[model samples]
Structures are given as C-alpha cells and as structure tokens.
Target chain A: MRVLALLDGTPADPDAPLIRVDDLGLLRGDGVFETILVVGGEPRELGPHLDRLARSAAMLDMPEPDLAAFRRAVDLVLGTWSGGPEIAVKLVFTRGVEGGDGTPTGFALGMDISPKVIAQRAGGISAVTLERGIEPGLAERAPWLLLGAKSLSYAVNMAALREAERRGADEVVFTTSSGSVLEGPTSTLVLARGRTLTTPPSTLGILPGTTQAALFRAAERAGWSVEVAPVDVAELYPADGVFLVSSVRKITRVHTLDGKALPDSTGLHTVLDGLYESEY
Target chain B: MRVLALLDGTPADPDAPLIRVDDLGLLRGDGVFETILVVGGEPRELGPHLDRLARSAAMLDMPEPDLAAFRRAVDLVLGTWSGGPEIAVKLVFTRGVEGGDGTPTGFALGMDISPKVIAQRAGGISAVTLERGIEPGLAERAPWLLLGAKSLSYAVNMAALREAERRGADEVVFTTSSGSVLEGPTSTLVLARGRTLTTPPSTLGILPGTTQAALFRAAERAGWSVEVAPVDVAELYPADGVFLVSSVRKITRVHTLDGKALPDSTGLHTVLDGLYESEY
Candidate 1:
C-alpha cells in the first residue's frame, strides 16, 4: 500500500498525476529528499532527517523548507497508511515550476518497505568498492560540487549501484580517488575493530549518517568506544566486522567484499542491534 | 506560447500535472534529456541530438528510448508552437515510475527562448572558472561516474552556475583539479588563438558538444584550423577570444574571464558566425 500527501496536509492520490511538465525537480533534478523508516506507524528519527533535509536545501541554496508543514504532511501520510508496521516515507522538496513564481513543490510519499531491505537485514549482503572519481579533500574546497548534500541528482549513485550489480554484487561502497573509503551509494560505511566502532567523518564530503550517529551515542553510554576518522579501503579486509547503516535499511552486515568471504560477527551484530532498538 | 507533447504525439496541457510523484526522474534524477534550438519551426541538428540522447541512455544502462516516438513528439510540439522565431525544445526521458512494470516516461516541451539567452548573445557574457573537482584522466577510468552522459542529474551544474552568479558572473567554466580547462556548466569551451579554434577533447569525460562539432566542421571547410586538445587555465589569458557554445544559447562570446577582459575577435566571430549559418 502507498499513500501520498501535499505539504499543506492534503491527501493526494498516489497513482494520479502529481507533477507538472515544467517542474525543475523533473527537468533538472533540482531538489532534495529524505527517506525515513516507520515502525508501528511512527516515523523514526524524524527530527534528524528533517534537519539533514534542511541542511541539504541550504547547501543547494534553495529556500528553506517549512518544517511545520512537512510535519503535517508526514502525519497525514501516517494517519492514512493502513499497511504493515514497517514503511518508508520519503519527503521531497523541489524548486518548483520553471516559469512560475518561486513557490516550491513539496510532497510526502509513504510505501511499504522493500523486501530487499528486509532480506539484506536478515541475511546480509555482498558489496564491491567503486572509485568515486574525486579527491577526498575536494569536498570542502569545492562547495559547488554539492558533495555532502543529499540532492536529488543521484544518477551517478544509481549508476554506481548498477555497476556493482553488473559485477554480481548487491551493493556498492564508494571510495575516493586516493583509495579512502567514503560511504555506500545509499548508506554509511561502519567498521568494527573489537571494542571500537569507527566511521569516516562527514568532513570527507560524505553524508553524516543519522542512524550511525544515534547508534554511536547509545553505544557510548553502553560502554563502547566510538570514533569518527578517515578509513582506507585496505582497512576493510582486516576489520573485525563491517556494516552499512541507513535509516530504512538499518544495519546490514557485509558478508563478502569482492567475493572474499568475511568472518562472521554474530556477537557484535546482536549487540549493535540491541543498541539501535533501545536508542530509538 | 509553450507546447507540450507526449512521446506518442499526443499534445498535453503544459500547466497541468504530467508526472507522478514516484517518477525516478523526479525522485532520483535517473533520466536523460536533450535541449535543441528551433529556428523557423525547424529543430537544429535533430539527428545528432537524438544520437547523443541514445548514447547518454546507454551510459546510464537505461532502456533505449524510442527515437521514432521522440521524433513524432518533437514534430507535434513544433506543429503546435505559436511562439516567436526562436524556441528551445527539450526532450526528457526518464526511468519511469518506481515499481511500475518498467515502463519509461517521456515528453517533449517547447518554450520561448529566455530573454537572458538573447541578451547574452547580443552583448556577450562575463564568466568565472570554477574547479570541477575531478581529475581530467578519470573520465575513461570511471564510467560509472557518468561523466560523458548528459543526464538529468544537473544539481551540481546548477550549483556551479549559482556560484558564478555569486561572483557577479553570468556563466561558469569548469576546470579540472589540476587546472585543466573542461567545459562550461551548460556549454562547451571554445578558445580562438589567431586562426586556430581549440576545445578540450570529449575524451576528458565531458559531453561531446554537438554545436561545437557542427561549428568546427564548418570552420575547417572555411579555411580555419581546429584542434581538440587539453586546454589549461593559463591558455585562456592569452587567447585571441573565448566563447561558450551550446544548442540553445548558440554562440555567446565571453567578454570577461575571471574579471579580466579578453582580447576582442570581431573578425573571427563574424567569420565563424557566417560559417555556422552556411553549414547549418
């Protein structure tokens, strides 16, 4: 089941036409979006996702979105959703019609979570590392690149995932030109080395992982060390365990990288899962 | 007046809703597009633009767009156009609605050329060079980056143009990390030094400029030298003249580059303009 709502809290038919031909969001991908996970009819980490969405909008120099309206739209979708406990709600805000006034096009869409996400969380996934083709240091120096912003121009990210699929992998982990591990095409890279959990810092131009941050904060209170630092591709092979974290996908263990089987980390997985559930 | 047509030759209301909320073109920018200049009801270089559109689709691993359908759509829009002598006809092809049996979404839109484009063509433009944040050699090595494809994922390109606007410039010329000149945000870089016309090679992962190719082919026959080579930022300072060329904007002379006045080439501009008109 799927539900749709306008930013003004109006319910829209999901299967009907919803966007104009001249919308810049469709014409030039001039937009920002966020996907949040819903459990038991409640959206998880809604505030953080909204914050990041605003940050992305600011990075694109777009007008700031109305958070109060977005909250109403989300509530509308959730109230209308009659499906399962788990749903993925996406908030879309775009620089609207090309020749019209500067009013933005905004909407919230709710749908059932993909079976693939559920399967990956259960049985893990295989991933391949692909070159991101940009230097890590260029992120801060080149703000126009929009490296850290979760803009709707994700064709390259989708292409990277297809490249991974062509290589018989389920996901892609993007590495900088200098072989520094950045993040996944749609998730954040997390590596566990015994008692420490480390992820690449957002300063490297990758998105700051909301799920990882929440988990890390709770883990610190639960007596685990958390570190944010640069990670290298070579470090993945020797790590105790590796995972990809996202809002909808949660934590998915990478079972094999480049077809090399990795040692299982059943104990750590349980601990991390418990931490995430308790924190949320 | 503006006109819109579906790929099947059906005319549609440009002001009404024409896209679904789940269209990947809107959600993820997973699509391809072409903007062709129409003069006297004729689309300039239609064949080449369609060829490039198909190539971009191939690069994105998308389903081959139906060219015959696109042709009919373009013809329909042209037939219905009641605009002035100049119009910009844009063809958009997307990956289609998410989870909807793999059907693609496509449309052709025609609108009057922007007053800004006309103004720039008449009086020229000021441009600033911005770092593209990628190595020149990465184009071939990183195909998944979609460097050569003119995909709809243009948020970064739009951002670069905004950055140029912030610097009080009308356009942006992108340079590689090592200071090798690439292309403009929406145009191709062409530098004239004496009798030689030079542009950066398309092998550098930039889109092969259809307008530049047409201009070069005509210039060679007009007894002018043409070269496709790596251009450095330093070369722009000593060039006889610099221009940005595109299908819609046509040829726009860069009056000032990075706030420095470039040498005038009135003779060459007239000669090149004549050649382009005669060839087309």
Candidate 2:
C-alpha cells in the first residue's frame, strides 16, 4: 500500500496535483505490472519481470509499451531513492484510461519503491485453497481473459490473499473448484519431490515466472530434475518440500495448510535463495 | 484516443514533472469513474452519475469524494466549452493516489470532455451468448460481487463487449452457462411482454442504470407493466421486445442474435425511444 508515484522519470508528490482524465488501468483495470525486489539499488530479476510484463500486456489486448523505457523508469526511481537497506519495488503499467470504444491509447506507468518487507516469517507460511482461480471451461476452451496479464485489475487477487492471511497464513494458493492446484496470488507454486523440483506449466494459464526459471537452473546444478506438470492439492500437501517463489521475497516456505503441518525441508529454500542472491 | 489532462484544477503539460510515488488507485486499481454524455455543453445525468460514483467507491471500500467540488470541476470544463452538438464527459475519482499500505490513501479526481457519442447502428445490434458473465458460485451465493458498484476493474466487462462487437453486434447480452440471461456488457437487458417492460434484478448482480430507472418510470406513466426478472437465451430471441439501456444511448434495440431474426418490434423501439427522450 505504500507507493512512490513516478510521473515521467521524476518521483512526483504522491498527491499528484492533477485532475487527470485517463488512467485505463485504474479505470477499466486495463494494464500490466510487475514487482521486483531492489537489493542495494539493483532490480532483482530484471529480464524475467520484463518477459512476464510483455506476456500479460498481450493477454489484456493492450498495445505494448516500450519495455526498455519501462526498465529505465524503474532504475531512475531506484537511482534516486535514499532509503537504506532493501525494499520491494512495484511497477504498474496500464493502458491509458480512455477508449472504451475499443481503440487503445498510450500507457500510464507508476512505481512504488522500497515497500516495507514483512521479513520472512521464521517458521514459514500457512495457506489454504480458494476457488476463485477456477476456469469454468476446459483449459483448451477457456479464452485467456486477463488470466496471463498482470493487469492493474488485481482486486480479486488481493482479496484472495487477504482471505488466506485472515485464515492465519502468510499466503494463499489458488485451486480449481475441482481442487486442482493453481499458482499463488503473486508467486509461482513449486515443490521438491525425491530428486525433482516441479512446478505448473504456463499453458495452464499461470503467469510464466522468472523466479521459477532461476530455481530450475539452480535445481539442475544441485543434481535435481526439473519438471513442469499439473499438480494436485493432495500432492502439494505431502511434498518433500513446498515454497512460493517471487522476485522480491525470493522463496517463502509453506509450513502448514488447512490446519495440517507440511513436512519441511530447508534444502530447496536455502539453495534457491542462495542462487537468487548470487546471480541477481 | 485524444484526451485533455489537468492537474488539481489547472491545465498542465501531460508530461508535467512530479514526485516518486502515488500509491493510490494506480497500484491497487482502487477507484471509481463515470462517463456522461454532454448534450449542448450540459452534463445530462450529473446527479445519477455522481450517485453511482459514490456507490462504487463505497463498494471497493474507499471514501467518496466531495460531490460539490467534483461537480464544480466538471462544470468548469463544461462551462468553458463552445457549444457543440454533443460530447462525452468522463469523471474519475481515485482514493487520492497515496496513503496506506494495502489501504486507500486518498483519491485523484479527473474529468475529461471528449467529442464522442455512442455509435449505435441503424437497424440495431446482434449478440453472442458468452458464458463468462458471472462465476457459477458467486452467481448464486455471493451476489455482492456483481451488483451495482461501477468500480474500475472492468477488463472482463469490456472484453465481453469486444467479443460481441467482433461478432457484428453493437452490444452483447451475457447468459449464465446454465442459460439464465444476465445483462449486457454495459447496459441492462430487458424483455417486454405485451404492456410489461421487465429487466433483470440487481439481485442478479447487474449494474443498476440511471437510464433503466428512468425507463421503469416512463413505462409506469404509459400504463405499461414494469417487471425485473430473470430471462433465458430462448426468451430473449423470442421476446415481445428486447433492448440495452445506458446513459447516452438510452435504448438500443436488439434485432438479431446468432442467425435468427427477433420478432420485428418497430412499435416497441419507437415507443421506448420517444419516452426515453421526452421523459428521460
């Protein structure tokens, strides 16, 4: 909720003394965004965040913005920030708030830097299933309606997260009403098997995440198999290791779910965090 | 789309300089807006629009803006305009783009007067039955998600409209997957039976329309029965009359759906349009 308002390249008064007409993202919720952790003024997963941003924009049918300029905007704010230590940087890019007649205009981008990180809870996160993520039709038949886009229309996503938090958990994992596992609100779902680190395939309409990519490489280096497959709720709860992966809070482990304790292993979390820090 | 940008109350450069963070509606999509049709430099439905804007803010859990000041800002723009035949006026209010963590800061209020009007077709509209309107569970249990408030998170609503337009319709009427009729992408769905003009109830989660309320009043004065009830796709195609209602384009007739011609209702369209203009 704490955000820095970046208008053009300069940080403006959060009270942007403006009677603005267009904010398509905030209006129709018509845009895409990303959240990257800034560690010592460097964005945590630049390449991956940009990659997902482009994909989500396409899903929303928005005319893509200049990705390079967007990256520079992030860096410009990071360059000027004097806040000590590390913080989460959130970038929101929306199709300018006009043209409901179906023609897209330019885009509006806002950046919020150094959000207070809830230091990773030592014991790990507790989560529960939410049916909001279910696709009503067959996967092949479901039109990708904002599913792939990290559009500013994220009220439901935030709502689901709150639902999980209210239930005494740090995060929530989305599930189909049929109980098939979907991804976390802002993170990718990943778990370790006997020797394999597995996550859901992107074709399941989940955002293709950069953190999971890096972890895949890390898993390879640790002599583990990496597979992208559909995972079920039953399988997730009993996994050898469970965690949610994102750019800022690299790897948050799930210690419990629905009142049951998940068998834990710090091996995946430690190794993944180590890899994320060293590489990015 | 061409637009005009104003800051606070002054006309400023679109690229005006600013501070770094505005954690307002931009990040959370926490805002509400209304687009009114300006007829002869006068806002046609200012009272109803402001009423709905306040309702949308309250639904999304944000405080309402000062309507006296908001109307003043809108009037300032309208008063200055040289008389035009007609124009579109948009009013936007955000929890003034900065404040709390995952909470509303305040809101930004912006208004734009555009030279646009609803592009209605000569004969009328055709539509497709998209099953994506209301989620199955919420459609029955939590009607709260669908009724009344006009929040800015409208990606899917716009998408449904786009899909209808693509199929050569001016607008679309959404149907439940199980075949119950919902409302249009941006208008209320109505069926006329003899002297009765019936629309779907807000209990079904349709955005209640100022225009629809006017229609109900006019129908009553004309000695017609006015009803609000659920209809199915079959009833829509075989109805005594069908129309989409909104602020600017008060009543657009639905002439065809799929390939079947609706029973010709020239009498209904003429009666409705006359009542809409003279009374509404």
Candidate 3:
C-alpha cells in the first residue's frame, strides 16, 4: 500500500505502507497529535512544539519521552533531504495497544506530508462560531484527562474545519453555546483590538499553542497589548484584526465571518512576522 | 528491537522490528492504538475495536484505514503465536514519518507480547465526581471533538485512573460537576437492579463500547431488562450490583468504592458471567 511519509521537513515515498492501526482513532479517540509547519527548510518554534508535546504526553499517561531523542530524530531528517520551501509536519501518538492482558504494545508514531502550505487567504478566513457543542465545565474537571493537550483524537476539530470549508470559509471560530468565543479548529484565535492581542485562556481547555505563546511574547516585546481572556464570538467580527496562529502557518489573517467581511489589520502581521523571523 | 508481530492473527519473527516510529510516540504522540485479548486462541470482539479506531482516525483527519487486513492479522496471530493460556494483543498506527523535505516518513506499527494477567479486586471501583470542570454542556455540544470516542491522548484518563487508584480504588468514574456520570477511564459502568441491566447513554460523550453493546444484547436475551440512561457517581454505592467491562478481562466485579463496599447482586453477576457465553 502506498503511504505518505514525513521524516522531518521533507516529503518521502507515498506508496510505502508506513502505518497500521486497529482504528484506535475510531475505537476510543485515545491519542494526541501535533502539526508543525516547516518553512525555509527549518521547523518553526521547535522549543515550543516540544514543550506542548511534553504537556500533551503527560496528559495521556505516558512517561515523558526523551526530548533529546525527539530532537535528534527531527534533526536527522533535517540533515538529510530537505524541501526548503514549505510543508506541513504531522505527529501522532496513541495510548499504545492496551487491554485484555493490560500490557502495552509499543506506541505507533508517524509523520505525514500535509498541505505544503495552507492557502494564504488574501485577507483572512471567514469563520462561523459554533456552540462548541460540548458539555460545560467537563473540560475543566477533566483537565487531567488532557483536555488542553493536542491529541490524535481530534474528530470535532476536524469537523469544525470541514464545517468552515463547507461554509466557504477557512475555519471555524468555536464559541460556547452561550456565545463565548473559544478558538479556531487548528490555531489559537487571537483578536487585535487596536494594539492589544488577546486569545482564550489555555486554562479553558484550548490546547496551548507554541506558536501563539511565542507570538504573545513577541507582541508584548513589540509594545503591543496581549491579553488572555474570555472572548465573545459576537465581538470578534468587529475587532480591529483577527487571525489564526500555529507552528506551521504562523499567522493567517481572517477575511470574513458568517459572510461578513472583516477590517484589515497589519499590526498583527508585523508582530507575528517578527516572531517568525526569530523562531522559524 | 524485538517485536511480536501478528498480521491479522498470524505470528511472525520476534527478534526483528516490524515497525519503527523512531520513538515518535515520544515526539508528537501522533497515533491511534488498541489492545485486544486472545481468548482460547481467538481474538475477542475485534469489530468494535476497529470501529473505534476508525472513528478516532476520522477525528485526527487521517484517511480511514482499511480494517479488513486487521481482522486477518488477528487471525494470523491466533493461528500461530502458539503459547498462551490467554494473551493480550496490541495494535498501533501513526501518520508515518516525514523526510527533511517536509514529507511523511514511513509508518510504524508493532504488536506487543501479552502482559501477565493478574485481575485482583475485592469489589467495585469508587469514583470522586469532579464537575467536569469546564464550561457547561460541552459534551453535548461538541460531539465532533470525540468526547466519547477512545483516543490515544489518554494521559489524563490514566492520571484520573491513577488518581482513583491512589485513593484506593480500581478506576476513576468521571462525572461532570453538574452531577451527571460519564464513565470510568477504560471501562463502561454496568449496574443492575433485580433483573434490570443499565448503563449511560452515549449522548453524554462516552465511547460506545462494543463489549457494552454485546452485554446489552446478552442481558436482553437472558430476559433481563436493559436501559441506557444518564448515570451519576452517587448511583453506584446504591446499585444492586456493579461491574466494569472491557475487552480483555471480560468482567471484573467491583468490590469497594471510596471505602464503601457495594452489595452483591446475583442478578448482576449472573448477567456479567453470562455475557461471556458464546450464545449469550
């Protein structure tokens, strides 16, 4: 079977079967995953990505893996064939095969070639706010269950993106049923109100973003206000600027929401670009 | 590295590596995983496991894997592996690896040797209810995010179970602070009152368990009433009989919870044991 293999930053053979699962993704959605973007032949924000990976691994009950080994593996790929343009890097982990005898089969890990680069919307993505569709307060109570950690079991986020795609938009800006804005499916939602850049608190079960964290620091250093607060979807469209931030696509501006066009903001682009320069 | 390989159910070399993630499980936690028990040389209830894996894969936005080969792999192992009273089987999948050009590397998969089975418990598991600690109604709202599907991102469930185990019980029974019961880390809660067998509704975001579904069928054929409804942790100590059901151990009678021993209901045990019967 042909398979897509992602080593570090380069794309590999597509026909080699590289993965097999009993559909653990279907059975329990019992894993965490990561997506890193490669730009100019380098992985962006490796430190933050590793930090988030550690946080996510702790959430899944696995021992913290050797970070040095992880770095080495990525470095190994980098030292070999590099595309040097742009590409998506995917990382996935399961609980390992478990049950019956209560023993662990080793974990299945793989890299996949993804969209070389997200289509950069000329202005930004138009998004719709769904009620987040989750039971209230459970994410907080089950925080230890790794609510904020990026897991391989990302059905809804995938669906949200699909929903966005369906709506002819780039992504969904998740909101509580009660109307509080959460974040995007794959990226952290940051609002630029004049000069202040704000995102939902990670404590609220949004997976902490290495890219967003770095951007916030850069924003603060750039003398831009950065806040982590509860945001309402209703107010998002009117914000001076709105964007999605992640390790791969450092910042993608939002163009429209619910068919309504949003105003332009270059301030966010400036701060985020500086962050990209220093990191990626 | 040594690995016990099973293609469907057939056994292969043990001293060789059938898959390698380069320890990707340590990197991004990017994969889906499952564990099945070998019963009398036959794999128990594999269809449900594959289904769960598919659901999780969809959640991760990976292509749906063809599980037909998995069934054959299990058969391959059962046809070989020759030694065991009973054993556990593990299956895992990753996104494969990527190259320095930012493409996916080959995928890695491995089957683990069974762990020693030592089912020990005097009684049922006791759970402490946390209010799910997040926004209200997140589970009901966000079904797409896989509140109920089993995913490898189980760091928190393991922690929750560890927390429960630390408190002197078997597994953690998760509940929303709203007073609605979710489920245990790994098993679904089955309770009985007289001849009535009951569990929680999946609308609450619990992974639909194949074992539980089989139990429901078994209970009804045995002329016991079966009901799937919302349950709270408080209902446990008062149930006539309680047991946690999974693929491997089949059924383990819960003995003590929060130091309080639950009463033995012949009805519960009868149904529990009856479930293993090939004709139940």
Candidate 4:
C-alpha cells in the first residue's frame, strides 16, 4: 500500500504521522471521499471522480476542494505503487482539526483492490433488499439530510450490507419506505429489459455512481438506450437482467435477488465488459 | 487540550498519530463516541455515559469495550488537566484498521468546553425544527439503519445544525417525517408542561441521551413527573418550557422554535437547574 498526505496542496511524507485526533472527519465523520481505479499507474475516470468529490464537499459545507492538490497527491501515490496490479486510489478530504482555521485535510491512498470485490465480479452476487428507512422523494426537500452526497457517514450503508451478509446474501439493494428500489449499498442499481437499461435516479437520495455513469455512456455508444427512472422493488425481479455498478467492482451481475435467480447474463456481460474495457 | 490513546488497556502517546487512514471509523464511520462533562477533574455521569457507550458499541457489532482501559485513559487525561476549568472529555471507540482482527481503537481527550456552548447556557438557544427524513416508528424495523445508536456518522446531524444556523438559529430540533419532534442534533429533546416533563421515546430512533436520562431521574426525585412519549412539533410551541439536554451543554432552554419565542422558562429553569445541581 502507498499513501501521500496533501497538506495545503503540498505532498507530505507518507510515513510521518499526519492526522490529528481532533480532525472533524474522524471525530464526527465530517468529510468526503472518492475511490478511483488506477490501471497501469494511471487513475481511471479521474474527471468524474473529482467532480463528484467537489460536489460532496459543497454539500457538506466544507470549503471547495483543491483539485490541484488532489491531483498532486494522486500522482505521487500512484507513482509510489507503480508496477503493481490494478489499485484503488482513494481521495479523502475532511474538515480539518476543530477550532482551527478550517483548512481541509486532503490525502490519497493507493492499494490493491480487495480480492473479495474482485471475486464478486467474477462470481456475481446474491443480493437482498433492505428498507432504507426514508421515504422516496424526500431528498430534495431535506438538503440538510446530506442525501445524494457521498459523505463519510456511511455507517448505515455498511450496516445494511452486513445485514444482507447475515441473511446469507452477498450484497444489499436498499428500498425506500415506499417499497421502491433505491440502489445498492455501495453501487448503483442498473436494470436491463429488452435492450433498454434503467437506473434509479439520483434524485432519490442515491449517490451518483461514477462507474455506472461511465457504463451508461459506453452502453449508449454501443446502441443501448439508458434511462434514469424510479424503480420499484417489484420491477427488479421481472427485469431481464440486473447488475450493481461501482468503480472498484466495475460491473457485477446480480445473480439473485432475495433468493431467486434473475435471468442469466451470458451475452450482456460480453457486451458490457467490452464497453468497460474499451473505455481507457 | 489533553489527549490519551488507549490501545488494548495501554495508554499510548497522544501526539503520536494513533489512527491509521484505513481505520473503518474514518473510512466508513464505523464507530461510537461519547462526550461527558468533567467537573473539577471528575467525569460527571460516568456510569450512564459508559452504559450508553457499551450500548452504542453493541449496536455497531463492535467487540465489548474494556471499561477498565477507558477509565485508565480518562484518569490520565484528566490528571494532565488537573485544576483546569470544567472540561468536556470525549471517548471514541472504533472498529480499528479494517480487515484486521477487528481490534477496537479507543481514546480519550479532555478539552475546555467551547466558549460558545458555555455561552448557550446563559443565552438560551434559538432552535428550528427540521424534518429528519424518516418516520417515527421505523427504527425498530430498521436496525441496519442504526438509527437509535450514537454512531459516528453524524454528518447529517451536523448538517442539520448548520442549516439552522444559516436560517439565523442557534440549534436544531429534528422532527420525524410524521411531524413528531425527535431530538436535537447532539442533544435529547425535553419539554416541560407544568411540573411534568416529557421526552421523545427512544423507539423513535433518537439516541437515548445520557444527560436527559440523568435529568429525568433527578426530576422524579424532586417531585416532577417524567414521561417518555413521542412529542409532535405542534405541542412544543404551547409547552411551558422546552430545552435541549446534553452532557456538555448541561440543560439549555430553547428560547425560540422557528423564530417564535417559546414561553418564558422562569419557573421550569429554576426547578430543573436545582434538580441538576442537586444530583451532582
């Protein structure tokens, strides 16, 4: 693993102690983060990831991110991990030490993708639907809720995934209080039915998935129609195919929902994988 | 500020960077925390705070916290700041470096209470009611959401408070989607109706407040009726008095709700303050 800390746009020694216990990011989980895949020592989908990071920072009322500082840190960390297998480069920016000038703490870390995530891509995953406790169409009215912002307060998301695992499932798809399919805990829910691809709209309080956005762009070029629509849980089971899309995991087919198998993805995987591979 | 990092029953250097970047507490906000008021070098309401911490740890599936380790760290940190004005001592425990043996990381830090929070006690806070984005009765069914747990994912709570300030208010009182008053961002909601005190039930997904619990016990002994019930926002405006109760802020009366002055809290404050002081 390689890490580089960006102190006010300057790269600091990775081995030196950097984070203070008083950082609001650690103390109150007040921060924003983005994970980009590095292929051949280069950050993939850099533009979209940086854009989302800035948006998250704005939602959290943190100062606008210094993208140049982020780029420097990413470049340094990736260089340190050169020649490694594909790595996940994570960019984190937090409200700095409390009672200070509120300078943001920014850093980048590069590490090999978790084997478990890689396995999910190859084996597909069994997903269970869980209630997200909030009703649909509430995100817009409650900006203070920090909906659609990828804030670091992800304990609920992690807990939902753990709940799925305890139920003998590998992943989770969250549904709103109204029984509408929202999105996966860490991934976007994209469904395909008869050549049309559909994903839940970000207006429903889901993080706009970077990989899903990339995949949609690629899929569109490959002559597939993509739509952002509200999906009900009942619609997922009847869909011809469903997949969870994320940056690190890329595109993963949901082999089963609850306990029943969805349609197999023999040809769809070939087409989607080719699109993802040809992107860079 | 005095800080101590406890590693498995041992006190480590406070200035040494204790948390790794990969700590799930920082990465996923997978942690629990408590802030207790230290008066004259003694932690007030220690038993209830620890009990709440243990409950929070259990809600997050963390290993049992070694209370002995916590006590030792607190003692050392408090001793470091002996004779200082009353301070706020914070305890944080997180599921340590992810994918490891799940060894928890614990720490204690003592700092003088923020002048702003101390000022609130003198100048009562103007509060606003904001929608909490969830129904009142959903927490029990959605344990995965960790609604009642004082998990570290306080981004939304903090955001709500910021939203209130932006609207020219001093604090926030969260209301459920059904219009029931929930709690403050970091405090418990307590409303005074004559000699009876009512608080929103914990079943409504609000954290069970340590200071609020202590206040209720003290109130009962002083001939005040305490009821744990769900309060609607409508009732707050007509109440005899309203207050946001927390350990650090002690018992702060809410002077206004949504720009409208609540009833003057002369008698209620006298009684509650007397009860609070008599307890300690």
Q: Which candidate has the top score in TM-score?
A: 1
Q: B175-245 in candidate 3: lDDT tens per residue?
A: 76667666667777787777787888877777676677788787788678999987767787788877777
Q: What is the lDDT of residue B65 in candidate 1?
A: 95
- Residue A176 in candidate 3, Cα distance off native in Å: 2.8
Worst 10 residues of 2 chain A by lDDT: A105-114
Question: Which 10 residues in a row give candidate 3 chain B its minimum summed lDDT?
Answer: B100-109
Q: Is candidate 1 or candidate 2 better by lDDT?
A: 1
Better of 2 and 3 by DockQ: 2
RMSD to true structure for each model, in Å: 0.9, 4.5, 6.0, 1.6
lDDT of 4 by residue, B49-108 (tens): 888899999988889888878887788777677546797888999888767787887888
**Candidates ranked by TM-score, best first?**
1, 4, 2, 3
Docking class of 2: acceptable
Computed on C-alpha atoms, the DockQ of candidate 3 is 0.21
Predicted complex 4: DockQ: 0.67
TM-score of 2: 0.82
User: DockQ, per-model, please?
Assistant: 0.91, 0.32, 0.21, 0.67
lDDT (0-100) at residue A97 of candidate 4? Answer: 77
**Interface RMSD per candidate:** 0.7, 4.2, 6.3, 1.9
> In candidate 4, which residue pairs get closer than 3 Å at backbone N, Cα or C atoms, i.e. clash?
none
Candidate 4: residue A67 Cα off by (Å): 0.5
Please provide, for model 1 over A229-276, each residue's C-alpha lDDT reduced to its tens digit, 9 standing for 90 to 100. 999988999888899999888988998998998779767777887888
Native contact fraction per model: 0.91, 0.37, 0.24, 0.68
Q: In model 1, which regions exceed 4 Å deviation?
A: none
In candidate 1, the residue pairs with backbone N, CA or C atoms under 3 Å apart (3 or more residues apart, or in different chains) clash, namely none
- The order of the candidates by DockQ, greatest first, is 1, 4, 2, 3
